[model samples]
Target chain A: MSVLTQIKQAPAANPIERLLLATEADMAKVNALILSRADSHVEMVPELARYLIESGGKRLRPMLTVAAAQLFANGTGTAVNFAAAVEFMHNATLLHDDVVDESDMRRGKPAARMVWGNKASILVGDFLLGQAFMMMVETGNIGALGVLSSASAVMAEGEVFQLAKTGDLTTTAADYAEVIRAKTAVLFQAACEVGAMSGGADDAGRKALAQYGLELGNAFQLVDDVLDYGGQSGTLGKNVGDDLREGKMTLPVILALAEASSEDRETITAALGDAEATADQVAAVVAIMERHNTLARTMEQAQAHARSAKAALEALPGSEMRSLLSEVVEFSVVRAY
Target chain B: MSVLTQIKQAPAANPIERLLLATEADMAKVNALILSRADSHVEMVPELARYLIESGGKRLRPMLTVAAAQLFANGTGTAVNFAAAVEFMHNATLLHDDVVDESDMRRGKPAARMVWGNKASILVGDFLLGQAFMMMVETGNIGALGVLSSASAVMAEGEVFQLAKTGDLTTTAADYAEVIRAKTAVLFQAACEVGAMSGGADDAGRKALAQYGLELGNAFQLVDDVLDYGGQSGTLGKNVGDDLREGKMTLPVILALAEASSEDRETITAALGDAEATADQVAAVVAIMERHNTLARTMEQAQAHARSAKAALEALPGSEMRSLLSEVVEFSVVRAY
Candidate 1:
């Protein structure tokens, strides 16, 4: 039986899983391409690379690329390459982000930087990025290349900006928005847009997919920020309060700080960036979040963006792929609940 | 007076200096493009970028790009963009290299990672690389882009290989050759090849330039390895015995190991990667190198590559630019003496 048939015969799958199942065949090709391209005669390059790439994250970004391409019937098979490139790009960022943040764990395992030294992590990340560009160039699509390249620059900027904001209580919600949009949303936008381009998307179709991806990405990050404080470690693949310890001023944090009483504000200010922050400190911060309804408010914002993501599908013709993409956006925010 | 006239009036400006003078006007434009593109409203990106970019080193790789393009009269101005891109690629590597090596000094000053921290260095390096690819795509030259993108992958592989070989006493001359070729020569090859492409070079012209750059790059790195032992800190922009302390099995070390007496071999191996290795230890290692004439032998190898670099230029038509390129090869090896 085909992979899709096998997936269908299994127990009920959620919307995102259903979307993934719908594109499993194409995504399998993408995975193979990623594996082949990630290889090097340099033993450590592939060893460290596979340690992260094969870690069981949802592969949501590449799946978006494939599903977006599936929205049109005119794909020229280049989407497989683009999808793999997107995954490489994402994994590259994760590798570097772990080093920059001094993160010990990723996807519930020791980070690549932890397993390998920081030197190997940095070089392997560079290798993956280099491979990503190679894949993009092989597509022979200059437009897609431009989109991905610009996203890379913007993402780096976002990261640097975030680093600069670390531990600064003055970081505003607008600043947080710019961070998420640049660091996270731009890649999603580029991935879906490139997929559409590979599928021979016209200007309108491409713009529609870009908008859809951007809104969905915003919603996804917003919920991710909420989960850092509200969800279990197993569900989040990381410790609770990681964002707080990293001094990342996510929307919920920004909102709580804005409305916090001086005592509660001091509590957060003391705990922010404290590596030794205890569980009680996290609970205290969550208590402040609850007092301001900041977590729920952030989820409400995510739901709004999710609505906008689904609304972007109106620009494209009605199709099963479009419906699946819309459903995936809703599922992204609903995970927070 | 113009830079060219000043260079001509000097009693004995080196061939490489003369080439820089010949291309001064074009390279100035390329420098401006680099500075402008390196900027970001995010602040730290530009701050860390300029810290390294403005650090005074001869912008040799970018100059090679411009000079190579100057060989042909039928040039589009795309070489300026390519030159800037080449410089960005080199700077990006330097930023990451400092982090990988835990280097404190670069170009006779504190490394960017020292001033801005490793996080900023890595992110800004990524920014520079992203900008480099953007410039390449802006040229709309897919072939040039392919050359650069592939060189990037090879360079990363070379770095990872070097990292793996760290402190490995079994590292062969052949392994060292591959390291330098991948880490250094490939960029030089791509820069010149793309310049030739921008100059509308025929296949033979492109191949000739590629060979010239590869041989010259090999010579350049061989001399660099030798300088770590023989040159002063001021001249080398780093302390003497840095390669030894870093456990890099460069050419001179490889040669010494091959011919050393058991006692001498043990002495050298003990000092390898020894951060606390004393002045006497370094002197002892140098004594072994002198006895075996390994340093001079390494220079002889550099001279051989330099000769080959000049020979490659013979494939091109006679022109002042071609002659200047040939002379620059001679100068690269002479720097060792």
Candidate 2:
């Protein structure tokens, strides 16, 4: 009896957990669709795609899509297709990013590029993108397709823009904000917007959800910035400080640079983008960031974005799904805290 | 008088020129659309995209799209978008292919990867793909979008499949044919098929154009295979024997392996995929292929496919565009002769 109860009563203690519990059945279908679509006659495609997809992602973006549809309380059944398509787009972007960033690990495993080589990783990303569009076309929802497609182009521009600004100490907070919006928030925005459209959302509802996603995405990115500088736990993991090593001008760095002493700036610049920088070098940079309290300021800004995200939820009717969506945004922003 | 005549009478000397002459005004718009859509606020995106787009290869795929659309008298003008989209798709594939093949040159210039780095080339490729889909969505022709999207996926599959069989000595003739069809032919098939669809080709016309494209694509790739092995001029140019060096299981190699002596096989195997394979080594392999007469056999197959391509055009009523298409097919296959 105890074993049966334990198996049946999965914990929903946190907001994401609760959200997951609420959308478990829907996500199961979404998972099935993702797996089926990821299948290909070419053996390496599925092998690489699966290794990445099944590697420990929380499936946050697709869940937002499904939850958005559920919040609308109606759907044309295209929501499932949109949800799966959104996930594919996300995964495709990750595969490309792995190559673009020369990332050796993803979600705590060897990146697909490591397993299959860069060429395979890239071509599989393209294949998944094709499969994504095919699924969207199958829905015959051209409006939603347009939104997602436009978001995709915009997202690429964001990445390129960020690439241009890498290691620029003069990069302002505004620049980081724009990059985060374009490269990070826009995908989240498109996922929710399209999900709402597929779920029969009217103009106002779609706009509100779009705003919600964009703000949530910004908050999500800023918090990630904080985590890279030693989050609320104040412990540096191996993966920590990767952005700095990559010479990325994230919010924490931008905020810290605004007031950094020349000597501190030198310390930061030397370690920045040095592939072989020692851990002590990174920790020294972290110490400067701490002295400036930039991580805390970044967290405050994240909380503000998170608040705006929840405020956007007021535009929609109150429902169990709506609260879960709001809480998920809250859960995401406070994660570093 | 000479200058005026040179400017005025841009001679339509070849079948492709005739097609170009026939579709000049439409292709002008297609070119306009191509340039406009390739424009991105991201500086590197347009810089890299234009470099590849402006390279000296004739705009063959987009021209095919324009010609196919013109073949049908009726049209909704979405063919311009489809043509531009097709070109972007082609360019995007080339950008990706540049990285995948690790080739040093494309259309006689340093590959885009060499100029901007592989990451930029790949991201720009993804950006172009996104732009392609956005243009297609703007047209609201789901059918054409579906065709192009599926082709994109199939083309990637063909590439992956080809990569898998790169050095397999036991690869069959059938495998080579399928790879060429998937990797090379489907884009051509999709180009013409989508064009005919946009142009309002009736069912029979559409089917005929599709068949024509598939066979023509096969011919085109076969000719390319022959060209890689000393082409029509019979001189071992700098680029000759590239396919053998890359260990590509193209038709010439496939057919030659079927009849090679053990000693000849040893020579071919030693040079296959050897990046540092010398002129002497490649010349020795070419000598083996010549004795086996595989290049000629490959050209014969190309001619057969070309004949089949021209025959498919017989289903349509004779017209200037139709004749131009037929001639283009003939002109494509006999390039090596």
What would the TM-score be for candidate 2 when compared with the true structure?
Answer: 0.95
Residue lDDT tens for model 2, B1-337 = 2222432365557877766666777888988888898898778888999999887668888888877887786752788898888888888888998898887778767889999988898889999999999999998989999999999889888888888899899899999998999999999999999999999999999999899889999999998889887765533222777788888999888888889988999999999988788889989988988898988999899999999999999999987667778878888877776
Backbone clashes in model 2: 0
Local accuracy by lDDT, each model: 0.90, 0.85
TM-scores, each model vs. reference: 0.97, 0.95
User: Candidate 2 regions off by >4 Å?
Assistant: A1-12, A232-238, B1-12, B232-238
Residue-by-residue lDDT tens digits, candidate 1, A185-260: 9999999999999988999999999999899889999999999997655677888998898888899889999999
Shift in Å, residue B172, candidate 1 = 0.9
User: How far is each candidate from the true structure, as Cα RMSD in Å?
Assistant: 2.0, 3.8
Chain A alone, TM-score per model: 0.96, 0.94
* Candidate 1 residue pairs in backbone clash: none
lDDT of 2 at B141: 89
- Which candidate wins on TM-score? 1
Residue-by-residue lDDT tens digits, candidate 1, B80-178: 999999999999999999999888899999999999999999999999999999999999998899999999989999999999999999999999999
